[model samples]
Target chain A: MDRKKNISMAVIKRLPKYHRYLMELLKNDVDRISSKELSEKIGFTASQIRQDLNCFGDFGQQGYGYNVKELYNQISAILGLQKDYNYVIIGAGNLGQALANYTRFDKLGFNLKGIFDANPKLVGIRIRDIEIADIDEMENFLKSNPVDIGMLCVPQTSAQKVCDILVNGGVKGIWNFAPIDLTAPEDVIIENVHLSESLLTLVYLLNEGK
Target chain B: MDRKKNISMAVIKRLPKYHRYLMELLKNDVDRISSKELSEKIGFTASQIRQDLNCFGDFGQQGYGYNVKELYNQISAILGLQKDYNYVIIGAGNLGQALANYTRFDKLGFNLKGIFDANPKLVGIRIRDIEIADIDEMENFLKSNPVDIGMLCVPQTSAQKVCDILVNGGVKGIWNFAPIDLTAPEDVIIENVHLSESLLTLVYLLNEGK
Candidate 1:
């Protein structure tokens, strides 16, 4: 497979959606699907699907369409899910605890190695058998454990500080839930799950016609 | 104060971000900001900021820049934060409970009216004085209470079913955390927070150069 260079961010964003739909098809034991059929399920246009798949590699055949299992594996590889990621949650608050308990990430090869919190009451609690450590210990913990991803669930005031610790401690990726956007080096990737922004967007759209 | 006709989705998506930055300026007692200053803070170009704000109304005078409080208030109104939205969470698992306990939404004028879960273990448990009810009772509850938004944190298999019930009961918006893309009527707005896809995006970026 000849790898394509400089895939657009729009195409990168769609890769996960492709991965998701392909996974669903695999679950239902669907052996093959045409771009038109996949488009109907995924809500992207058929041409858009063909174009997106072509960014990573030639996926679908002209007459035979796409082999479901093959497409799924290709997207999975494109999404970098072929390997496991060791991670840590920086805050053990309601959101952090919830994310810690979410088993879906585990299924997708994200392994949670530690959970840290500043709250004394929460610091000793065990979630999924990984005892919550004091936030103060996170720097040393990350030094020894060597995390690939750091999940930021801390409050906004402390988010940057926590993020700095993660970056200095060698974590390359940040899955931020904190409301504030933390600054990071160019090599580090930050993906924000801004819940407030998302809700406000929904509210704005719900009232768009009015 | 004539609003621009047909604001693009790209501009609409950036509104919440502008709202957030403007609110921060207000918090710091900063009364005015140039587009360049805001651009530095927000990571968008000065021209881009001006273009986005222009979608809703004329903001920012040449040289005088923008009045922080006024811009904040206008963006708040534009984002529909002026009115309170009564909402229900349809699954009381980890993510649902995390969102329920997320007090930031409450501060932004989203009121939690009820919480519903199919799990008997979570039923009747009170989160911020609002008790979780039987998931089966949600349809009847919405009939009497009339929520504006439904937060779907349920499993993939049940998300669409739960979404349909909310829509049928007259809910106009959905803040979805489930992994699946849900179907709703044209008028009903759906905003998704796909955590798995987000994590995958980060993983893909982290490994992009490898």
Candidate 2:
């Protein structure tokens, strides 16, 4: 199984969708899928699917198409889902609690190690058996129990501060839900889910006719 | 203002980010910004910023640069933020509740008129004065209280069914939080925030070196 280097971010972003569709196919006991059939289910063009899958490796035969389980497993491996990732939520606000309770991430091998918030009232509260700890303990917690990812769900004002703590504590990936963008070092990866910008974009598209 | 038609989706997506940064600038009491300075702050190339802003109308002078407030207001108008958008959450689970509690959306004129849920316990619960009603009441609710956007936070199984109801009830836009890709009419815009896919992308990037 030879792999290709320098896969484009566009293709990397689409790999999860491919993984998801393939998983659905496997759930329904589908054995194999032609690129055309996969395209119809996944909404990408057949040629685009072929090109994207080819970026990782040669998965499909000319006429035989792709093996469902084989493709799913390969994409999963490509997505780094084969190993479990432990992460701690920095701010246990509504968004933080929502993410903590989102069971799908856990199923995808992402574990919620701890949750922290500055609010005194929220301290000691539990979400899915993980206790919400004091914000001051976060750096110490990270030093003792290192994590691969840091889920930043704090307010924009404090987001960068908490992010600095996370990065300084040696976390590599940040799944940020704050509306503001944070500056980070070269080695650390930051993925932002800017909900306001998303809502604004939706509104823009809704009124694009105007 | 001479507004251009058929702005590319790439430009549309970037408009929100520009709006965000300009808002920050206004909050900081910055009155003007040159394209080069704006580019450094916003992480886009100066030429790219000039091109994107030009898609709407002439706002900047060659050396005088852009009036921050003027540009911000223009982009807000372009994003349709000047008008209030009424929306309802289709499923008041963890994510739905979080959206309901999000004050930023309210500040941006996206009003939460209603929240619907299938769970009997959640049906009568209130988040910020808006009560969660039975999911069965959504169609009737939509008939009387028309909404601009339908936020789908339901499970994938019920997403399409609820989406169909929202569309049939006359929603023009959908902010879907459900993992599945929903099918809507050409006129009905759907913006999906697929958390699992986003998380997978982060994990994949984190493991890109492996």
Alpha-carbon lDDT, every model: 0.90, 0.91
Q: DockQ (Cα-based) per candidate?
A: 0.75, 0.77
Error of 2 at A100 (Å): 1.0
The TM-scores, chain A only, for the candidates as listed are 0.97, 0.96
Q: Which run of 10 residues does model 1 chain B get worst, by summed lDDT?
A: B1-10
For candidate 1, lDDT tens digit of each residue in B1-210?
337348888888888998888888888999999999998999999999888887777888999999999999999998888889999999988778888998888888888999999999999999999999999999899889979999998999999999999999999999988899999999989999898888888898888857
Model 1 preserves the real interface contacts to a fraction of: 0.74
Candidate 2 structure quality by residue, lDDT tens digits, A1-210:
235368888898899999889988999999999999999999999999999998888898999999999999989988888899999988887788888998888888988899999999999988899889999999999999979999988889999999999999999999999888889998899998999989898999888766
Which has the greatest lDDT? 2
